[model samples]
Target: MSERLTLPIGPQHPLLKEPIHFRFTLDGETIVDADIRMGYNHRGIEKAAEERTYIQDLYMIERICGICSHTHATNFVQAVEKILNVEVPPRAKFLRTVVGELERIHSHLLWLGVAGHEIGFDTLFMVSWRDREIVMDLLEIITGNRVNYGMNTFGGVRKDMNQEEIDETLKGIKILEERTLYYEKVAREESTFIARVSGVGYLPKDIAIAYCAVGPTARGSGVNYDVRRDFPYAAYDQIPFQVITSERGDVLGRTLVRVGEIFESVKIIKYALKNLPEGPITARVPRKVPQGEATSRYEAPRGECIHYVRANGSEKPDRVKVRAPTMANLMSIRHCLLNQQVADIPIIIAAIDPCLSCTDRLILLKQAGEKEGEILTWEELRRRSIAKKPL
Candidate 1:
C-alpha cells in the first residue's frame, strides 16, 4: 500500500503572491486529490457596494481588482447604463475600446512576467514587464493614470484622445507590437521556456467547458468564446480582430493564446484609431437611477467579467454583484492538479491567473487534526506576524 502524504501548498507559497491555500493529497510526488481554499483577501466589496450611490459605486468597482480595474469599472457602468437606457456616443465607444485593449496589453504582459517568475525565468519576467511599461505610458498619456484609469462614466468615458495623443498612441502600439512578437518567439522557440510549460497542466476542452473556464484558460483549451466576439459592446462590433485559441490545452497553450491575443489587441487598437469618429466623449446621464436590474459582460484581461446591478430608483444601488473571470476559472484547478507532480503546482495555478482579492474574503483557518480549530481574520494574522517579529 502506498503511504498517503498530505501537503499544504499555500496561503503563503513561493510561486503565488496572492493568498490561497491548496491542500494536496499526494501519493509520493504525484498528487491524487487536491482541495483549494480561498478567501484570503476578500474586502466584501460586493456587499459594500449597497452603501454607495451609483456614481460612487463606479470607483468602488474599480477597486475590486487592481490589475483589471478599468475592466471592472467599465462592466459596472455598462450594467447601470443598460438599466437607465443610456446610450454612449460613437467616439466614447471607440475610446473605451482603445482603453480596454491597452489594459489587455498591460495585463497579458503582467501575466507573462509572473508566469516567467514562477518557472525561475527572471530574465523573461524583467523583459516582459519592461515592455509592459510602454503600454502603461500610453495609458498615462491618454487617461493621466497608469494602473487605475478612471475613464468610464455611466454614459461614456471622462477623457478624450486628441490628435496629438492619438499619434503618440499609434507609435506606442507599433513599438508594443514589435516587442510582443519578440516575446512570442522566446515563448515558442526557446527550449527552456517551452520545456517549462509544454505538456504541463493539460486542461482539455471538455473538462474546461464543464468547469466553465473563461478567458485564456478557456481559449487555451480550444474554447474560442470571447465576450468581445460573442456579444459585441462598445466599438468591438466595428473592430476587426481574431479570438486566438490553441489545441494543446496546457501551460504552453495558454502562453501562446495570450501572446496571440496581444497581437490581436494591437490590430483592434490600430483599427479603432484609424476609423475613430469625431464626437463628444461623454453624454448626459441622470443623477437618479430608475428601478431596474441589468447585467453587463466584458472581456476582461483574465476572462469574461460579468456585473449585475439592481437599482430601486434611488441614487444608491440596492444590490451589485461582480462575477470575475477567475471565480469561474478557479473551479478547474482540481481537474488540472490531479496526477501532476508537486513542483508543477505553482505554474499551473499561475496559468489560470487566479485573483483571490477579486473573488473571496481573505481568512485564515486553523485545523486541529481533521476538525476545524479557529478562524483567524486577516487582522489577527497581521497581529500574530507583528507579535512574532519585533518590527
Candidate 2:
C-alpha cells in the first residue's frame, strides 16, 4: 500500500458552505478512516429561544434555517400549540401543507444544484437553480418573502392564500413540474451522472439504520421512514402523497430519492390547493402557556426535524430543544466516507444535504487563569453577554 496521509478539510474550506472540520486518514487516494468535528457555527439559538416570549421565539426559531425557515417556524408553533391545546383550522392546516411542500421543492432543487456543482456538472447546477427560482417566486407571492417566509404563528398560519395567489402558485407549480420531470429523466437516463454517482459513498441499509440516519440519507438506503407518512404532522395525514425511497444506497440513490420527492411534493401541493377547506385561518391563542412539555416533528426537505419545548406556565419556554435533520444524518457520514476515494468526499457529504448552522449547539470557552475550558449554561451565557463579560 502507498504511504498513509492525513487530510483536513474545512472549518474553512471553499467546498464547505458552513464551518465544520473533517479529518480523513487516507491510504493512497482511498480514505481508510474519517472523523468529524462540529460546533464551529454554534449560535445558541435554543438558549435564545428561552429568553424570548413565545411570539418572539417564533421569529427567532424561523431563523434557525433560512431554506427551511417555515419548517422550523411550523415546528416551533406546533409545540406551542400543543402546550396550549389549540386546534388549528382545517383551512390553515391545508395551507401549511401547501407552503411546506413548496419549501421542499425549493430546498430539493437547491440541493440538486449543489450536488451537481460538487460533481463538476455546472450545467445541471445552473438549470436546477434556474427552476428553483419559480418556487422562490411562489413563496414570495404567498408569504411575502423568499428565504424567511413568516407564514407560521402560534395557532396557525399568519396569512391565508387568496384565489389570485392560488392561481399564480398553480402556474408556477406547472412549470416546476415540467422542469422537474426533465431532471428526473436526466437522473434516470444520463450516463455521465450515473457513472459519477453510482456506487459512490455507499451506506448500507443496516448501517444507515444503526446510525440513526434521517431523511433522504436513510430513504436512499431503503429505510422507508418519512415523518410525514409515519407520524403525519400538520395536514400530512390528510394529504395524499407517496414516500420516495431507493434501495441503491449510494449517491445515485439519494439523488433519485430527492428527484422522486420533488414529484411527490408537487402532487401534495396540487391536492392541497384543489381540496382546500373553507374556514378561518388563525385560531385564538392565549399569551401564556400552561406547564407542560411537548415535542413537534416535521418532515423537512433534509429529513425528520424535531422540536421539543418545556413550558413553565410562563410567556417563554423553560427549555427549548431543536434536533435538525443534519444532526441525525451526520452520524452515518463516516461510514459512507470509509474506503471511498478522496475525490468522492464532497459528494458523499453533500448527499446528506447538511445545514451545519442548524446543527450547532454549544461552544466552550477557555477563560483567563482557567486550566479547563468553561461550559456555560444558557442563563449564565446570557447574563455574561448582556454584561459584556468575556467568559
Candidate 3:
C-alpha cells in the first residue's frame, strides 16, 4: 500500500500572488483531502468601518480589493442610500452602472492575463492585459482615476460624462468588443488553453448551488443568479444585457463566462451612455444619517459583493459587514481541488477570481509535526529573518 503524503501548497505560491495556504493530503498525484487557511491579510476593514464617517468609509471600502474598488464603493453607498431612504437621481444611477461595468471589464481582463500566465501562455497574458488598458483608459477619461474611480457618493455619483467623454468611451468599447471576440475564440479553440482549462477544477452545479457561490463562479456552473438582474440596481433595469452562463462548470466555463460578460458589460455601458439622462450628478445627503440598517448587493467583477451597514444617527456607521464574493466561493475550494493534480492548483484557484485581501490577513502560522503552533506577526517574521554579515 502506498503511504499518504501531506503537501503545503502555499502561503506564498507562484500561482497566487496573494498569501493563502492550502494543506493537501495526497495519495500520489491525486489530492485526497484539502484544508485551506486564510486570514493572512485581514486588515479589519469591517471593524474599522464602524469608526469612520459614512463618507470616510467609502474610501476604506474601495480599498477592500483594488480590482473591485468601484463595486465596493457602489455597494457601500447603496447600503447607506437605502438606510437614509434617499433616491439617487436617474442620471446618477446610469453613471454608476457605466462605472461598475468598466471596473468589471478591467478585473476580468486582469484575471484572464493571470490565468494565461499560470498556464505558460505569456503571449496571451500580455495581449489580454494590453487590451485591458483600453477599459482602464476609458475609466480614467470618465472618472479621472484609473483604479479607484471615486465615482460614487452617498446619494449619487461625484461626476458626469459629457458628450466628448461619452463618445471617447464608445469608441473604446467598440475596440474592446472586437478584441473580446478574438480572445473568446482563442479561449475556445486554442489547444493549450483548452488542455489546461477544460474539465479542470470543476465545481458541479449541485455543489456550487449548495456552497452559495456567487457571480461568474455560480453562472459558470449554469446558475443564472445575477444581482443586477434579480435585484436591479444602478440603471440595470433600464439597460439591456443578458446574463452569460455555462453548464460546463469547469475552469474553461468560468473563463468563457467572464469573456462573454465583457461584451455584456459593453452592451450595458453603450446603452446607458447613449440614453444617459441629464441632471445634477450629486444629490444632497445629510452628513449624519438616521438610525437604520440596510444591505446592498452588487455583481462585482468576481461575483456578488454584499454590504451591510448600520447607521446610528451619526456621521460614522455603527457596524459594517462585507460578504465579498471570494469569501463565499472559498468554501468550494476543497471540492474543486480534490482529485485534481497539484499542477492544476493555480489555474483552478485563479478561475474563482479570489481577492485575498478581502478574504485574508497575513499572520503566518507555524505548525510542527501535525500540531499547530503560534501565529507569527509580520514584525516577528521580519525580525526572524537572518542577516548576512557580509556578501
lDDT of each: 0.90, 0.92, 0.89
Per-candidate TM-score against the hidden true structure: 0.92, 0.93, 0.92
Q: Considering summed lDDT, which 10 consecutive residues are worst modelled in model 3? A: 359-368
Winner by lDDT: 2
In candidate 1, what are the lDDT values of residues 1-391, reduced to their tens digit? Answer: 8999999877888867787888999999999999988777777787778888877889878887878888999999999999989999999999999999999999999999999998999998999999999999999999999978999988999988889999999999999999998999998899999988999998989999999999999999999899999999999999888999999999999999999999999999999999999989888988779999999999998999898999999878999988899999989978888899988988999998888777873333454566756679999888988896564
TM-score (C-alpha) between model 2 and the true structure: 0.93
Flag regions of model 1 displaced more than 4 Å. Answer: 361-391
Q: Which wins on TM-score, candidate 2 or candidate 3?
A: 2
* Candidate 2: regions farther than 4 A off: 363-391
| Residue 219 error, candidate 3, Å | 0.9
Q: What's the best-to-worst order under TM-score? A: 2, 1, 3
lDDT of 3 by residue, 260-322 (tens): 999999999999998999888878887679999999999998888888988888778998988
Which 10 consecutive residues of model 2 have the lowest summed lDDT?
361-370
| Residues 345-380, model 2: lDDT tens digits | 999999999998788865534548878766799998
Q: For model 2, name the residue pairs that clash.
A: none
